[model samples]
Target: NVDKAWDPIRIACHVYIALHAEKNEIVVEAETDDDCTTALGRIRVTLFHAEANERTCRARYIVEPPPASYMRKEVIGVEVESAEIAKDRLDRRVKLAGPWLTQKEKEDWEQKRKELMASNEKVFADHLGSAFINLCALNSSMRMRVQFGNIILKRYRTEMAKPGFAFDKFVNMMGQSRTGADFEKMVGGIELGFKLIHKIHQSPDMFCPLDNMTGKLSDIKPKQKLIYRKCGNVSFRLEADIDITVRGGEYQLGENSLYKEDSALKKRLDVEFLAFNSKFDWALEIMTQERLSSNSIAIQATAQDLLSSATVEQDVMDFPYPTLGPKRRLNGKDTANIHTIFQYKLMGTPYVVQILLARGICSDVVGYCGASMYSTNWDDHMGPNEGEICERWKLGSDLRVLFPLPPSTKQSSFATGGQVVDKHEGFRAFLAAVDKVQTFLSEAVSEK
Candidate 1:
């Protein structure tokens, strides 16, 4: 019996951390899954159950509980089904009498049918009654769990208020202060586990855990994701996919800006373009001018919580760099593909990456960006116009990806919180990249 009058000391023993002193001494612990002692495993299961119950909203709060339903299915369905079976059985028995039955036989058959119907009705009623009774029991069992979970948690909190010498050693060994925060953390864990189980839905048949068993929760394994939970609210980061598009206005924009730069230099500085095509003179001129944003937007935090975690800190030391693909064709005389490992700081986070720039001025630049070999034979080459690869920048996420997150942690805050809204930093980085390419070109042009 899950009695309310149970010993507070017994409930306290169920906490796994309190068992250290008795490590050498024989003590009551969670030896079995259902053994409600302060066994760590049982506590985990209890938290799982409490969370599941909260998620499905099966167990109601004692203060203002909702109307209860058992298995949330109708019990009257059983009565209707039982009545049909009884009628079918009676009809089958009556059919055994041939078409040429005597009056006595017919009368006797009717009487027997009547007797059977009366007995069947009683049986059906009993069957329906039993189902309902069990249904109530099931409902009550879950309610008891909710009640007991709260009660035991409260009592557990009290025991941890200032743990006795018995558990002091264990608490200290674990580096726990046994503060109220620690107890609340345990409570939070139960809530988080339940929400996660509900979200993954890996455990499809998650019941009340009224039986305090694993049920379908066994399907889930311990991974980095299971240990994760939401502890904060919605947030937005800046994201700017500000590609350097070739606008019609570029034809008129940059000549004036370039003249302004040269005039400011006090003399007409000599500049020469080597190994350069004339088609991009206009784009280069326009790029010298600053880009502007005339629009403004306001956003608010959302109600949907972060799925895993919002902030994921990564370390370059922990990961090995990606494998580089071999050049499609190579020769002793051919120059190797060179990339600048440009390091820059953004919002105080330093990013060191291999920055390779491709001038989209050449029509064949598309071939390289599209993963096509520059040789006479082309197989995986996309049309030069595809992605406007030749007209604008030959670089974008499809080819030159920026700060791609680790393969894990796709999105979060329901796609609101993690690694999005990066437009401000993004455009700033884009400008930095553009400047890097420009600086390289300027140095080449200035060379005597």
Candidate 2:
């Protein structure tokens, strides 16, 4: 098909690699006409390997023209060069998050990485809080926490939207027995479940992730990786599950209002971290208790349960029995007689998100409100593989500011704060009137 003047110097080459086999082919064509449609010589190249598959090994080949008088088909020569292994090749894939640490921080992290790799047992960080001191800076931690929180919310919303959706399925996966029917009654009713409720500053901008998230997270931010080692970057994952059950025993809305003394609350939290590069894993369980004084009261827990002393506590500084630490937000005056209950379980969700970055991978009871910790090994309670840290923590304005209160109630300061509407307000008013009259009659008799 030659259409142009012969040009032996010009050669075109293409290579094709077979997916299912180790064989690769390289084609060489020499143009011989001006039409660019004719080739005077064609040579086919085939590669053969002694022990390598298509998945690994690098290859190089060479081709030469045959003598003019001795040609018996085109001569193609192949040479085997040293092949590079897969692990040694340059890796050019997307990384989650890294290259954010300073030089000194990277060096420090490397030393720690070496230590962790050398140890057979896991390194435990009991009260894993968002302490800006950890390798993951405070700003980075917050960004990632908000991102992960949004993911959980999105997944929840998607699943709930489907037909025959049940919240109990998620709870059960987290190892709980409560069903969807039970969850609806705890927060008043299905309509009231997950209502907008805020605490602390109650500013919508500062607290809620749902409204603030611009888009999905491409990669979990504030991720860490050891500079000296080949192990992959250390990333974070977050999950939130909730269950609302009646206190002491299950009760209907109107049937047991008078007989019930309080609504006992509980938080069953499980935190775990697995370090593949370090070859270790750490995990722990947390159980918390609280109570709402009565129905119709928006905010209802004790000060110890509402503030920092509930989840993050200082054993030496706070009262001994409560064993609480400093408050994340709010003062004594702010929490005084404030109702801690809300239409939705908004308050607890943020804490679950923040605590993931609190410390290293450890199983301890440090960042939970009125919580107790349990472990398989009793000796490891206080340290790695051990016992509980046992400190109380209060929810702060930063976590509460996301939820804005409805316009109907503006007289209150905190979103959760409001006037109580007792179910038997009229009866209680009548009883007060009768008590005043009886007191006046007794005073008159004494005077006579």
Candidate 3:
């Protein structure tokens, strides 16, 4: 009963065609091979349509053929149901131009993002710059200021790269802080971190010794003793058992001798040195002090040598023996000789004094003349520690010291025909005299 009253279900109308290239439509006549056979016919495409309106459309050609010249393929296409559906589809496929964000949030986000990016970039740049400068200074002997600037840049870069921190964070941190102070602290921290990491990475043996389960010192013998010392601005451990003995004194046990065989003591020393050398400025100061001490010793030795080479002479007139009428002149060759020697000694003294002055030995000269007492002292006094010496020198009282000459040296021919000499030459001579005086004063102080 179901089959007798059955009717075909109507399918939705859609245009369908099989497309192919013309070159693939060429016919080929060949013999059959095994289970396969060949065909000699032109290829064409078949189109399918359920409505008369669809029939007027052009049909595509087929590029290849099988048993028949053409075959029809079924096509299923979707129709837009509503404007909202179409819009949703379009929106998913394409990006819309115009702000989809709210006003206040968008503005705030944009401003914050820009500020963050800028701050981060600046810090990063500074970190890298400082690193470069330090590298130059360490390797190529760059100026301290130049090296310091570079280190600042390097620190900025490093800080910028860290998470939850950007250039802006650094800027804010520095806003209430001094320019170089915060930067210096950051640099110091970074340097310490690097040193700690380097020790861990490069010299693991020192930190991680061979130990048993009891956490006691291992019986294993270390090949070399680690002697830790604070050098310049860095703390370094030397692999040597250096003997420390008091000069011109009896050798006493546990008095002046420092041994590194004791691991605990060595570790303590290492920590102390590291802490001392952590600050760049402090390290430099230590180095400078050592240098000045060494130079002072050398200057003293030179002065002694000069004195030994010179002779002295003295002359004296003696009164007549007790109740004698008048005083008589006596031949005092020894006194004359001593006086002559003293004169030579005085002359030779100036040379050593000059050297001392150059090395910055005399404190009185510094106090009296307000000049640098030593190289280290000069650097410390003029550099960041005391104040902005270079800035002040360039823009303040120091400027007068630099240029003591008048603006013009020439006078009109019509005016009084005075000597038309070089004022610049005279200024140069004046400076030279000042330098000579400084040198003399330095040497005299060193000798003392």
Candidate 4:
């Protein structure tokens, strides 16, 4: 839970600062692989006293909450013992399935689980040990001071109110098995654990922070070559507000009132790029600039091979689903090789990701945004036969990224009420929530 909350708080503050005390707008082009469908969306962000908001956000987080303060020590000890018992049961179950295991795939899950457990056990044990010693070494007054500090930490109540905060901590401390390999190996198990928690807790935003934190943790750093390397064939447009005709792919479009650094529309477009880059691991390059009749700017470039040269199996799972029509709903996770076409800057800009599927592999053309099974919409020409012939295969989940959500400028509002939206609505919810918070705070302060 601490780890999950950590990212949003950090990001919310980071974005609040990044807006630079200005109203910014973003136009997003969310598309599926097929190139047949796209969602055109726009977001407007208004920052009120951004400088003061940033400070308020920072100041609100000044004090720390004691880990698991609500649970009594005895309760914690019981939970620790229960986790060990569950681990034993899980070990036995995995062993029972050994008859089905192949020689190459023969691996013990217990080892990974142990590592995760040890990390948590060590933390809890340290706290217990301190308490044991403190009983004799520290007086009542000292304990009172500690307890009082936790109570006075003004942000603790709001932080704890975040959806699924308690359950998140519980899973981290007890449900998760530590594994060294990245989330690729851990996602299935992790998702199952989170689902179980959600079923019991029933929070609308139960898994929101967990999902965001997982993505943040899973994000790989941009490589040196990946950052500026030239890409292959792709096309885009350069547009502006003025009435100048731009030849296709032949001219630079930064010389007029339309391309001014401080233009409202230009600022909005720049923030969109910032949000897009923040979400995906693509190494973007402005290949060529072209002017379309619609008075806008675009640069098109193919998704260069930014991934490491490691074998496909090492990078993404090879699990396949059967080929289906564009309207079919995906029942399970499907893995495929994906090709990204163009990253554009428009509310309705068409972004395409091609899914190359193997025999028995199918693509999910549509579904809810937060659900794991949705696909980057499919290309009409994709075939099951081609998947077997293709040498490259990668996970679709890696390519179907969530929309960008930079934190709003209002500190207390986002800090207090941001978890109401799930993955799909997150971007817009962030703007709306913070706007509401800003309004409330302004009125409250004015009344004083």
Q: Compared with the true structure, what per-residue lDDT tens digits does model 4 show for residues 120-176? A: 334433332333232211111111000000001111222222333342242332222
For candidate 3, lDDT tens digit of each residue in 1-448? 2121111110111111122345534322233331112111111111111111122121111111111111112111122233322333311111112223456545655666556545543443333233322222111111111111001221122333333343223434333312222112112222232232232233223222222322222222212111122223322222222112222322111211111232211110000000101112111111111111122333233222222332221112110101111132112210100000000011111111001001011111110111111222223333323234333233122222322333333464223567434323323333233334333333323332
Runs in model 1 with CA error above 4 Å? 1-97, 140-448
Query: What's the candidate order when arranged by decreasing lDDT?
Result: 1, 3, 2, 4
Superposed Cα deviation of residue 143, candidate 2 (Å): 23
lDDT of each: 0.23, 0.22, 0.22, 0.21
Q: Tell me which of candidates 2 and 4 scores higher on TM-score.
A: 4
lDDT of 1 at 101: 34
- Off by more than 4 A, model 2: 1-209, 215-290, 295-352, 355-448
Name the TM-score of candidate 2: 0.14
Residue-level lDDT of model 2, residues 1-448, one tens digit each, is 1112122323342222122223543233323343233221221101211111121121110011112222122111111121211122221111112123466655665665455433311111212221112211111111111110000111122333333333223323222222111000011211211121212123233223322343222211221111110112321111111112222332111111111211111222233322111111122333222212243222222221332222222222121111223333433223121111221112212221111112111113232111111112212221211122221111111111121222333243333455443322322232232223223222322332
Measured against the true structure, the TM-scores of the candidates, in listed sequence, are 0.15, 0.14, 0.16, 0.16
- After superposition, which runs of candidate 3 have C-alpha atoms over 4 Å from their true positions? 1-126, 130-206, 209-296, 299-448
Alpha-carbon deviation at 6 in model 2, angstroms: 99
